[model samples]
Target: MEQTKEISALLQLIDDPDEEVFGAVSEKIVEYGKPIIPNLEDLWENTPNETIQSRIELIIHKLQFTDLAEDFRQWNVAGHFDLMVGSLLVAKFQYPDLSTAPVLHEIEKLRRNVWLELNNYLTPLEQIRIITGIIYGYYGLKGTEVSYTNINDFLLNKVLETKRGNQLSNGILYLIICDLLDIPVKAISIPKQFVLAFQKPGYSTEEADFASKIEFYIEPASGQVFSHKDIESYFKRISVPALPSYFKPLSNKKIIQYLLEELANCFDNDKEHYKKEELLKLANMLD
Candidate 1:
């Protein structure tokens, strides 16, 4: 009761003309964290002063960013290298209120649909075809080639909702569903593009010969399977010499870092300097 009363008193001073007093009050309110958000929101709704409303909004954003930073730190320490969780955390930077349950449910539905059609008798290519049919044909998810630079293309939740995304977002979704279905699809970070590789059966990532174990590459945007020759040709076309690291499957942590780098690029294009810096900091945490 006393804490609530104190919060109420602090809320009253949010409109104080003195800048130092308002800053002190804002600091105290922020210490209350996420639980104080609803109260701040209520105050914003009721207050007639635009300045106070802006201050309240800033306080809310600060608290949310604090929570996001802690979540990212914990995710890095846990060391499970969960791709879905990392992608969701990246999404949370843009959408602080985002929930992972619905996103997981959507991915699970795709996994279940693909799982029903898969069997030991089917070849790896056939399995990929089935998944492609379910995701691209039946579900109507497509590549956002025209709006590729849009920041929304990088957010998993928005991609799931819109059924359109750039290479990385769609590729991540494809990888997560394949993972859930126990398929051997892995993300391969090539120059200027994100693609997937089908690992040969019994090829373990722990093995030193992991790079040689990739059977073929799959382009998630178009469900097209291509060979090493095709990758070579692509490198030639782009005028960049191919490196061994480009063919290697990226760990989930590295995949998240790549996604963050892409997101920072998006923010930079939009001229959102602070957001770009924040994303870069989060990306470095994976290191």
Candidate 2:
């Protein structure tokens, strides 16, 4: 609900466009600088209605914008995070190809079928785990060419059916699964490896998991489970450069750091990455 005075004042301000009022507001905002924020904030909280409080809060936030200088500049310099994040999301679809068994879309359809099968057997979380397995099963198949369409019957029926190891690409496919499933699955990126994290709403409240190490999720295409040693080896392979002091066991903090790196990779600055669509996909996996 809106407060009458705030709406009336807002309408008057909109209609009149009083330079005096604007000047006064701007001047006071400039004068007290950051110090005035608290009082304005107090007024905002004291406001009786939601709309009025929101308006007042926006004003206060603007008044306090100077403090955001570093953040804003960083956002601008990063080439804007949104484009980066968007690119990253799309980039994962690029994978090494094997035999020309099928086009990308057909494989996608088969993958989706297997995923639907996996979904049938387990709880949401368990579904995610098995689907992750099913995705890896597609690896080293007759097809690697990626597209929005295409299917390899042999790979779908034979390759995955035969292979036992779950690959990391399953996690990549998990992203799409998440998109479809509406689960709270987050992919954390490491220099060489990746860790996937998932959180979900439960009957109680919230639950989070970061137990699966990068190794637990292997890339059969590469044929190795990622490990701390693997990260060092990857850096060494890239020659970015030298060996580090120590390799640590996987931790949730590392998951968060990796997640941020992913955001950094994706360039999701100044955007609402959280949305119903993303959440639903995650929910399917995380639940």
Candidate 3:
């Protein structure tokens, strides 16, 4: 009852004309996080004052963003980094109300389709064919070639919804499905591109010798599989040195960092400095 009285008192002070007083009240309200959102919404609905409504909206955004930041920090410290969760965190920046159920359902549907066709005797190339057939042929997911610079192409939820994304988002989705199905595919940070590698049997990603066991690479943008020699040729054509780390699989944290960097670049290109800075801050957290 005392807590209820305190909340009532705070809601009454929200309409104070003084900016400093309103700021202090807003700070106190936001400290309660999402539990206080319904109360704020109720106050906004009951009040006709535009000033109070605007203050309520700002406080709601602050509380929600604070909740998301805490979630990201918790995910980071939670033992193994989850790529799907990390990708969804980036998605939450645009969609604060984004739910994981739809995303997981979509991924699971794709995994089941691929799983039915996979067998223990299948070669690595055959496994790639099955995954590609389901992802690109059946599902018809294609790369967003025309609007490659669009920010939506970098978000996993958006990619799943639209069935079209840039290389990075598509690659992350591909990696997630493969990981779920116990496939040996992993993300490799090739220069100017993001792709997945099919690791040879007996090689674990955690093992130090995993780099030498990469069988081949697959471009998720179009589900095109290629050999290591092709990567070397492409590197030569681009004038980029053939660095060993380029072929190695990236950790979930590194993959999320790369996705953030791409998001920052998209914002930078559009001259949205605030969004760019925010994405860069998230990227730094992964580091």
Q: Give per-residue CA lDDT, model 1, range 1-287, as digits (tens).
A: 23477898998998889999998998998888898898888888998888888889878877887898899899999989888999999999889999789998998888888888899999888999999999998888988662426888888999899998878888999999988888999987788788899999787666765558888888887777898899889999999977767767889999899888778877665545767888898888888
Model 3 TM-score? Answer: 0.84
lDDT by residue (1-287, candidate 2, tens digit) is: 23246434443342225667754554445455555555555666666767556545545544444333333334434553332222222222222123223334544664566556664446545655455445545443322322212212112222333432122333334444555555555454444544444533331122132332222333333223344465556677877753221222232223322333332323233453332233233222211
lDDT of 3 by residue, 1-287 (tens): 22498899998999999999999999999888798898888889999989789889878877887887787788888957989999999899778899889998999899999999999999989999999999999998988652536878889999999999888889998998899998989887787788889988787656665447988899889989998789878989999987776777788999988787778777665545656777788788777
Which of 1 and 3 is ahead in TM-score?
1
TM-score of each: 0.89, 0.28, 0.84
Q: Give candidate 3 regions above 4 Å deviation.
A: 1-23, 43-55, 146-149, 204-212, 265-276
Task: Give lDDT per model, in order.
Answer: 0.85, 0.39, 0.85
**Candidate achieving the largest lDDT:** 1
For each of the candidates, give the backbone clash count: 0, 32, 0
Better of 1 and 2 by TM-score: 1
- Order the candidate numbers by lDDT, best to worst: 1, 3, 2
Judging by lDDT, tell me the better candidate of 2 and 3.
Answer: 3
